[model samples]
Target: MTVALMWEARAVAGRGADLLAWARAQHLAGTPLRRETFRAPQDRVLVITWWDAAYDADLPELPEPDGTLVGRPVHRWRFEAVD
Candidate 1:
């Protein structure tokens, strides 16, 4: 079965570029990552990443961000692939 991990977090002021660079490096390192950013009504930045499926036995540990807001939270969701 295939599984996806979804993560969301708030970016620090003027830190989007750095965070994106890190994410790109992670993608190149072999995680099938799709990412995007958007602005909140209050002008804060939100980043979301979708990771491609990996087998439970072969799952890789995700990298952690160096800098971000204190209250920002990350979430993950997993799903099985269907034929």
Candidate 2:
């Protein structure tokens, strides 16, 4: 099974760059099949990671940023590939 984990967060005003850099610096305990980072309007940062595991399997995910860096709690989702 292939699973994709999505992590998204909104940085505090004017702290988007800092949040992005912080996110980029994080390291996972296990390597993923693929990983990518992205940004959107409103200082939102999104990271998607693809893994070779069951949808409900335990996986290493990026941790939440410091309170000063983010405006609110981070959001996350999991999806399984479909054919």
Give the TM-score of each candidate: 0.49, 0.98
- Write model 2 residue lDDT over 48-83, tens digit each, in one string: 999999999999999999999999999999999999
Model 1 score (lDDT)? 0.49
lDDT of 1 at 62: 41
Locate the minimum summed-lDDT window of 10 residues in model 1.
41-50
Clash counts per candidate, in order, are 0, 0
Q: Please report the TM-score between candidate 1 and the true structure.
A: 0.49
Candidate 2 lDDT at 50 equals: 99
Residue 78 C-alpha lDDT in model 1: 53
Scored against the true structure, residue 70 in model 2 reaches a CA lDDT of 99
lDDT of each: 0.49, 0.96
Candidate 2 Cα outliers beyond 4 Å, as residue runs: none
